[model samples]
Target: MIESISRRKLTVTQQLSASFLLVILIGSLLLSLPLMHNSNAPATTYLDHLFNTVSMVCVTGLSVVPVSQAYNGLGQLTAMLLMQIGGLGLVTLVSLSYYSLKQKMTLSDQSLLQSALSRSNSSGLRPYLFFIYKLTFCLEGVAALILMIDFIPRFGWGHGIFNSLFLAVSAFCNAGFDNFSTTSLTAYATNPIVNITVAFLIIAGGLGFANWLDLVRRFKAYWLEKPRHFKLAFQPLSIHTRLVLYTTATILLLGTVSGWLLELNNPGTLARLNPFQQGMVSFFQSVTMRTAGFATIDYQAANKSTNLLYMLQMIIGGAPGGTAGGIKVTVAALIFLLFKSELKGQKQVVFRNRSIPQALIRQTLTILIFFFLALLSGYFLLLITEPKLDSFSLLFEAISALATVGVSMDVTPNLSTAGRFIIMALMFFGRVGPITVLLSLLNKPEKNIRYAETDLTIA
Candidate 1:
């Protein structure tokens, strides 16, 4: 025990979890201060602040209190800073600090940073990380400026500038915590500028930094006429980028079309709007489902079919190595390919003529399996804890927490203490990932021993 307390090293996952826990605790304490709340702020417990801090740090937008009513300007800014840090990730920001200070990173630090960014090659990791930071801040700044166009006259310079910047970061981070009251973006359901700007930021952030880097490289290669053919130029992109793009496009298209069709005649959702606004709203909602929490329509009043659609969409979320959450689009794509290959009686799972390794397939399956296990566990636990709440809504809340999507069904504020704690666990696991958390606890390697194979009947 004494030795354990001495100077010791931590694995990447442990470092990540510890850094995040530190931020969450510190943010919780600061935000819980009386100075952070408004003069007439609603009463709240330390648990409320902790839960909010966890949600913010996890980039899950679920909240037990209306941010505007409970907190003053300082608190809102603090929350925004939390979202920014969470979205960029602590590892990323720390690396930026090191780089800015002209400090050489140790090999261990480099490895940890690469792992955090889901990057493979360490040779160009620093450049790639810097590129990500530049792209993120640049996009956020542009979106903020655009948002101010609509926000200034409506909210005035002081509130407008701050709100614009806040929402821009929130949307880009996919954090979804809004100061616009408890209704989220429902009041701006038909506001095209707001919807389009927010949706664009969501997509840009959700695409993942690695994919963006690949795209930039391919574009530069094509522009210089090296291998001239666009196809050949982009051929250098990793299979991961291709799958993420394909899956993201497919999900967005399908989600938008299905949502439009499902909500066509439903007065509670898009029925009251014009066809154009309905289309816009449908598209926005589809984008938001990729871990962006803003909701133009009241999901509670939405069609049951739409609710089911959202749950499925929320589970198959945006690309990995970005602000977005859930099992990730790559996992969904791989699982689908795995099934398709098996159904076709193919010897190997192939995508784009390249067969995926068994190890990666196994990893994908592990992630999916653990994800569902956590989701289901949280759902059942919520049912037991919040027995009086609507079962469907409770299930939605559970999925939202576990996916780190933060889209609640008006069930968050009324949650009991146990329910909030359960949600917090789910949120933490969701953001850090089930495998990551498990790996932190049980990180030792197993003996490389094999046993004789045995067969079992499928039927």
Candidate 2:
């Protein structure tokens, strides 16, 4: 298999998988340097450094130690840079640098972007990529300024500005990393400025990048056509954008309500807060639980129902082509639609008067199965590696890492060496995507001969 792969040119999937792995290894090396550690902090093994680097580059945020306790300022900046590279695709960044230099695209770079976006050609790829980069940095900058209002007043100029920028990047990358404290953002549970700013960054970054571009184009077209007549003209949104928006809104509303109700009477979690404050925290929890991974309340203190709900949300995650992970919102929505059509005894799956192609339905199921298997395999491995840990917490941690959600029931710090390795593997799989990784390794050729089809027994 190795010989065959070496002889053949690598496909786009293989290149992307290789690129991410390369970044992870390089990041681990950087984090292992002695200068990366705090002088007052205890010595760390290369294993710990690798683990931390993997967590940062994957944007999974499952650290064995609090970031502040582990590293100094330069170290934190390195980690932040890892999050940026991972959140923005490594290949995409390379393409961006080429654009900056006004260089013609290499065949490999053009092929990579085309495959990444599933576009037929590269005609509009340049403009689309530029828009995504500009939008991402602009949003992060705005969010950092907003957060400075809260952080600068408390930490003084230097620390405050750095903290604000770090958090803004972390939030917008949907990374759970916080230099604030070991508990993530618990200190600012009821602080409106922190909660709103962080939540906005997460949502904006999680919303599919293409969706934003689509919205902008539609807005421009509508305004340009306004002078044609007194009547207003609105462009129809793409089905992908419509589905993402609807699924996101529904999940947010349901998650907020479920969290609020689940923790209403639990003094350990949200019961101590006034009703208005509880609402604020509940909304933030809903926003972060779906793969953003920041925490306002102690998740372990909450009822079992809330944790269960969050795991489901984590599995659903954010949109495609976005910083967030998991199978993604569109995949979840398509699966639901697939089931609805099947239960209704309809031959075709339909959404918004548009009949879904069979190819898309199959692709959606394939993605779901890949993620499901990864989650289960990771959970079982964690069980074997850390038998002393609570089975429920182990399962929770597995889902968190595999979905790249990063929330835990305080299970991360106590993870055995083997357990930490397992979580790191899961985080990488979640970021690069299980299917993409698997496909990259296989050397099999397509079978042209077809066998006779037969129907299976129905349940």
Residue 438 lDDT in model 2? 38
Tens digits of lDDT, candidate 1, 1-459: 111211227667777777788789889999999999999988898999999999999988999997888889999999999999988888778888778888888787876777778765578987888899999999999999999999999999999999999999999999988886778898898998899999999998889998998888878777988457755766788888888988999999999999999999989899889999999999999999898888889988898899899999999878988889899998899999999998999999999999998867877888888999999999999999998999999988888888888998899999999999999999999999753844443345646899999999998
Q: Residues 316-371, candidate 2: write the lDDT tens digits.
A: 98988788888899889998898999899999999998999886786687778888
Q: Which runs in model 1 stand beyond 4 Å of their true positions?
A: 1-7, 226-236, 434-448
* Model 2 error, position 68 (Å): 1.1
Model 2 has an lDDT value of: 0.84
TM-score of each: 0.94, 0.93
Maximum-lDDT candidate? 1
Best by TM-score: 1
Residue 10 in candidate 2, Cα distance off native in Å? 2.6
List residue ranges in candidate 2 displaced over 4 A: 1-8, 117-121, 223-235, 434-453
Error of 1 at 337 (Å): 0.3
Q: Cα RMSD (Å) between model 2 and the true structure?
A: 3.4
